[model samples]
Target: MSAYAYYPGCSLTGLGKPYDESVRAVFAHLGLGLEEIPDWNCCGATSYMSISGDKAVALAARNLALAEPMGLEIVAPCAACYLVLSKAQHTISGYPEIAARVHKGLQAAGLAYAGRAVIRHPLDVLVNTVGLDAIAAKVIRPLTGCRVAPYYGCQIVRPYSGFDDPLRPQTMDRLLEALGARVVEYPLKAHCCGGSLMGTMEDIGVRMSFLLLKEARARTANMVATACPLCQYNLEAYQGQMRRAYGEDVTIPIVYFTQLMGLAFGLAPKALGIQRNLVTADPLPVTV
Candidate 1:
């Protein structure tokens, strides 16, 4: 069993609680130990990067600082959390001046920013470290009948580049395949799910979410499996809003890929966070 530093971010406790729970369960099943960073703070995500680059890096650095002394690699499940934290680590490690400033910020909190700890996303740890074969071996309820739309959102795979194959990511699809789920090569899988649009502009967010939902349904997918917590929340929570706003009937369930993985491990749906989904339909498609 491999032990790694875990950072759940803010949304995990709120909108992404299910995702958090599912991830923890799945990782445990795979014999991975996740130690949460004590006194961790938000990664500042997209908004912080736009508002103040240094501050954003500092905030993420604070989390990294907590993990460094412990000599453990940081692993995050949320795509946004993973991206910001990894990107921040990349920035500080590459620039001495920025590293110094980030260190100073951590110092205020009685910490030091030592940019040596490896920062990884949950998918990376699962696919690369644990190996898809391990995940396959643990599956007791294979998703043979389910046709999943593997959504990557935007942050986890892109711009960072080396995390996964950006042009055509296979990590999620491969993981799903290992669990007996059929993959639908969604053309818009990498498209933006209008992240953060919910708080800024409700109308545009509804439309954006509707477009994604409609695309998933058009492809005849059972449900959308996402690596991003924000995407899952937006797609699931706003399905009704999308239908009402567009005057079209839409009922697509949105779920975290980790949750689906947990289900394949024969864990109960409620334990995997399926009960909270807005679409009230079984996400797993019955195989014919």
Candidate 2:
């Protein structure tokens, strides 16, 4: 099988390095090919888009333009990157007025935009393209006792519900079950994890993060399985702040979904970047 053009986004190189490591590890283990696209730029992130739509699309479209020549689909692991790339693709394909401006911007940089690049979230690829039974067959260390709250955050499914349900996503839930883990019925799975909201407004953002993190714990999940780097960071790194603001200690292990999959595949914790997690679930392999 051909490898997908991997776009690590900017966040994946920073606090989200574990996510990068685990995603690479798991995909490699599953025999999926991941070619990191050369000279890939930022997807303009959320903040940049808010400041300037034209410039933001121009910024994000460059990555798509680069990937087009590669003749492979772009697999964006970061939620913001996935959304922005998807939006950029849509803008260039559907909005002619903006597309002309974006094309002009790309030409100045010695690149071109054709709207042919396809952007995908890795989870969608693994669960939808790879198939669950195939993943189950590779599991050497099943997550039998792992009760995971599959957090989807507000991006991914929203604005583009092509992969799963917008309101009630079940991709991660089913994928976790396939790995021999029990899925907690997390109602706010699609809710915002405050993302950069915590950075600008401490109280409101922390409150949002605290409530969602608290809900997962309240529902009896021992850990959270997230796809977005920002969600993982906001939910995991701010536990202490959340405790202070919410007056409840709802701290629990927060991890990338790929990390748990790596665990089930019998990959070592270090290989999956499990040691990089702030909260420790330190779980034994579940037998289902």
Candidate 3:
């Protein structure tokens, strides 16, 4: 029953509330507790870094500062938030001058970050800490007939280097299989879902998302599973918009890996936040 400092990020609280609910419900069912860091702020996600380097670093550092005092490992459900927070932690810890500047900024906010805490995506905890064998043991419903396309998005594992195998990531797939899902090799698993471009440059984002959805359907996959809040939000929220843009009525369900795991353990769909999704993909029972 290990617990980590959990940060649900801004999107999970707003645009991806379903993700937050599903992850919480799933982890709780798995006997893990996620302690929300008290007085936490946004990790400077997609916009802050481009706005100003100093502000971006400072904003992310504030989160580390809050988590360090508790001496718990930091976990982020959002890929963008996870990357930004991990990058800030690495940057400040690697450079003395930058560390000093960041400390000053933290002081202004009345926060002190030692940058000593370990930051990881929630999927890492699910695979590494919780262990696949434990997950296998609890799978009351094996996803035998279900074929899942494991989508990694772009930010969570990449650029962090060694967080996951760069070219070949098996974390999500292996976990899914342990829970009895027939994991399909998805070529666009690590491809970018065009992020915030869904709003600005709708065409490109839709094309990217549409292509991925097409690949899943072509592979005979029943659903797409993801570990990031943004990936889930972007892929799920934009399915209809992407269909309209592409002039086709495509209905593919995008889900968080945690949600699938919860279902494998025989947790009800309502408990895992399945009903809140904008897309309509039914959770079929695991035959095995």
Off by more than 4 A, model 1: 283-288
Q: In terms of TM-score, how similar is model 3 to the real structure?
A: 0.94
Name the 10 consecutive residues with the lowest summed lDDT in model 2.
279-288
Residue 165 accuracy (lDDT) in model 2: 91
lDDT of 1 by residue, 163-250 (tens): 6777668888888899898888788888888899886998988887788778887888988899878998888888778778999876
lDDT for predicted candidate 2 compared with the true structure: 0.88
- Cα-based RMSD of the predictions, in order? 2.3, 1.9, 2.1
TM-score against truth, every candidate: 0.94, 0.97, 0.94
Question: In candidate 3, how many Å is residue 23 off?
Answer: 1.7
- Model 1 lowest lDDT segment of ten: 279-288
Residue-by-residue lDDT tens digits, candidate 3, 59-124: 888888888877788878888888898889888978888889989988987878766979887788
Give the distance in Å from residue 96's predicted Cα in candidate 3 to where it truly belongs: 1.8
Candidate 2 segments exceeding 4 Å error: 284-288
lDDT of each: 0.83, 0.88, 0.82
Question: Which residue ranges in model 3 land beyond 4 Å of their true spot?
Answer: 286-288
- How would you encode candidate 2's per-residue C-alpha lDDT over 143-221 as one tens digit per residue? 9878899999978998864899988899999999999999999999999888897899878888998989889988989
